[model samples]
Target chain A: MALLEVKGLSINFGGLHAVDDFSIKIEKGELYGLIGPNGAGKTTFFNLITGVYKPTSGTILLDGKDITGKNTIQINKAGIARTFQNIRLFKELSVLDNVKAGLHNRYKYSTAEGIFRLPRFFKTEKAMDEEALRLLKVFDLDDEASVKASNLPYGKQRKLEIARALATKPKLLLLDEPAAGMNPHETAELMETIRFVRDNFDMTILLIEHDMSLVSVVCEKLSVLNFGQLLCEGETSTVLSNPEVITAYLGE
Target chain B: MKTKSKLIKPYTKKSFITYALLIAVFTIVQLILNFGKMSFMMQSLLVPLCVYSILAVSLNLTVGILGELSLGQAGFMCIGAYSGALFSSLMKEAIPEAMVRFPIAILLGGLCAALFGVLIGIPVLRLRGDYLAIVTLAFGEIIKNICASLYLGKDAEGFHLSIKSAADMNMAPDGKMIINGALGLNGTPKDSNFTVAFIILLITVIIAYNFVYSRTGRAVMSIRDNRIAAESVGLNITKYKLITFGLTAFLAGVAGVIYSHNFSTLQASKFDYNMSILILVFVVLGGIGSIRGSVIAAVVLTLIPELLRETIGNYRMLFYAVILIAMMLVTSNSKLKGRITAYTNKLKGLIKKEKKGEIK
Candidate 1:
């Protein structure tokens, strides 16, 4: 069974159809890509799948379980995790705490236990810290574990966001413009990280990227979106050469 | 990888320093009270110093940690003071020991205020920023006005409550008037002292620090930073907000109990909008999201006006206003704040070096 299956997904912000009739199936451990022109509803589609926006008409099934119209938190608990286009980190928190916050639901201790310095609080906190550090080590952010999130360099901040998302232990991961503001060297690094995440964590990744170099190198299957509609879907090289996808990009 | 024993968590170390500071102050006060001469004026300022410090720290939890502006702190304190005083008055005979009864009263006060926190938070937490501030301001006024005209009395028959004058209660002549209209609760036992207040203040600091370091605290701070991102991460934003709001109110209520027991009469009029604003001033001057700063600022600011009253005579308030403006300028200006941080870091380095040399 596919990890994520969206069928007849549609949403309208007043009169404008922000995402219209978007449907796709992503199997477990597959690297899927969603590419689109500016304002072509790529992020909005991510928002829909992650339950940021309620679909006007649709069904989103995660491993054959219908998850349509659930809120963001429930969807995350249902095994879908995502990162934002503009990086969102807990700015006031340390790098370690940022990942630990994502590990919140996994580790169990009551608020009262936390406040009272109970034995369970110490045990769970120790476990959480170790797990958070492990995730940070995977992203090579362990050395700067105590640095505030806002103080990190741009490239590290992007990596930290991904690390935090991974800490949630989701089956399906969505990356929105992961290489948005990177130069060629950093984009190269991010491509390797994306593949490394998919391989090491056995993650099913669905990412939106405008960087074709990173896209073609990383994504096995690609879906092109234009004017809030799916323009084409196929193997990466085949869809890149399609006439409609070309016109959607180059404006023939 | 660094060994766990070698690495001290930054928050844990910082909180230990706060506890040490509190202990040092407590020692100095007790020493002066016993061995050295202390003016009557200075003696009276002791309990108030602890109370204001507690209020400031609790308010900081809302304004600093939770990043929500709350003007209803005084309202919560009012609820705590009245409820706690009422309990003490009713149970005066049943539990005659001041030691046992006062602690229960303090807890009761805190719980009463926390109950109000949840109820008010349900609707108020939905509103953000300036709207939340205004609504909370109104809430304080509403609580004060409600308590002002409230009358409670107990007789052989039972307890009677009336919002009108004391006469409207129509209690039997043998009954005792616990709360008189506009006069507030009278003859509340004076169980609060400087030592108990100091202990409570220390506990408040510990709770505030612990709450900031915990997983639940992390969720609350994340919501403060970015609500949508926090929601996307599967943190229940509402639950965390309510927990923080309730805890903040609970601490404020604990402060109210201290305030009520320090005097024979507990008046709702004392817990006014100005009182809430005064505590906010402490939080702002200390530095937002800074627990240690709140405690230090509360102590310094509370003592300044009173200390200046004898030294500067009628010009004391004018001097206090000047200090307030100066502190605001220093804390808010990025350049000044950076310079202050740099100087403090340098000072800390020197202290560490000196301690190492002494040990050697």
Candidate 2:
């Protein structure tokens, strides 16, 4: 059974159909890539699935449960987490805290317990701190744990954003151009980290990437989009070779 | 290491020391005033000190942590002040003991304000930045005007609302006045004292501190830091925002209750937009998201005007303007900020060195 299945998902922002009739199915632990030219509605598709913009029509099923128009937090709890193309790190927060924010849904301590400094607050807090540090270490950001997120270098900030997303422990991870602002060296390292996470965490990943090199290396299958509609989807080599996909996406 | 985990702020040794020093000064000053070391003018400012402290700290949670502007905080306070004063007065003949009645009134005031928070926060949270500020400011004006026109009285015919003044409030011959229109609520018992206000302030600080370090605090801060990022992480933005705004309103209400009970007569005019703006100045000058800074700012700023009135005399407004501009210049100056940070770090290093020496 597919881990995620979207059927006829559509959204129109005012007069423009930003994302139209988007549908895809991915098995658990699959590595999928979303590739399209500029203004091709790739990010909009991610937005619709994550409930940032309410879809005008369609159903999104995660593990066979329908999750249409749920609030971002609820959709997150339902096992979908994402990163931004612009690298939205909590600028004022400590590096550790940036990741710890994602673990917010995992705690069971009540607000009263938190305010009162109950043992449960300490127990869970320590666990979260350890977990956040562990994830930061995976991205080699443990050394910068105490630094303000905005003070980190650009590549490290991108790594921190991904680390923060992973702290939520989602079954499905979405990346919106994670390699957009990196040098070749940095992009290579990020691709290695992405591959490592997909395999080690045993989770599904769908990334909208403009970097064809990173996509070709990491993705097992690819979906091509053009003007809010899917043009073609197949194994990476096959889709890359399709004349229609070439004209619509890569040919640019 | 143990000390780091013992408190909400793990590495803020300087702020911790500053907070301790200010709290000690507050207690010492109160004791000295009680001993009649200060004039009546100085002594009377104590209650206002605590009230403004509560107001500043709670408002910081909204402006600093929640990243939403609110100017109707004083409106919530008005609701609390009237509700609390009314509850205490009605319970007076029955409860008798000031101790029993006052606590209940404070809680009721908080709950009442929280109720208003729910009613106002839902629509207001949808608006952001400057627009949100304008709406809250309008709410403050609207609430004050409505209270000015409202009249409440209790008698054998139960409670009644009258806009034609309290004297004409149609009630039994033995009716008791709750609020007398523009004249405001009168004859409420003065059960609030400096000690009670101080205790409430401490509790407010503790709760705010704990909240800033908790998981919920992280979620709330994330919303302020980046709304899109927070939502995409699966945080219900509205739910967290409502909870934060509600809690801040509740604290402001408690402060209002304390202020109302500290005096016998209360007026809606006291909680105007100017008052809201004054408290915001305390928050911004203290350093946004710095709980300890808010407390110190509240106390120091409240004391400044009174202190200046005696020292600077008729040139008070001019002095205040100069001082405010100077502060802004120094705080906003990058070189000055760097120097201040470097100096504080040096002080911290000295303290750590002292601790090591003691261990040896």
- Top candidate on TM-score is 1
Question: For candidate 1, lDDT tens digit of each residue in B1-360?
Answer: 473433336778899999998999899989999986899999988999999999999999999999999999999999988988888888889999999999999999999999999899999999999999999989988998999989999899998899988888989999989999788899899999999999999999999999988888889999999888888789999999999999999999999998899999988898889999999999999999999999999999999999899998899999999999999999898999999999999999999999999999
Any residue pairs clashing in model 2, and if so which?
Answer: A73-B234, A73-B235
- CAPRI quality level assigned to candidate 2 from its DockQ score: medium
What does candidate 1's lDDT look like per residue over A86-192, in tens digits?
Answer: 99999988888889989989998888998899999989988988898889989989888888899999999999999999989999999999999998998998988
> What local lDDT score does residue B68 receive in model 1, on the 0 to 100 scale?
97
- Candidate 1: how large is its RMSD? 2.0
lDDT of 1: 0.92
Candidate 1 residue runs with Cα over 4 Å from true position: B1-8, B339-360
Clash pairs (backbone) in predicted model 1: none
DockQ values of all predictions: 0.69, 0.55
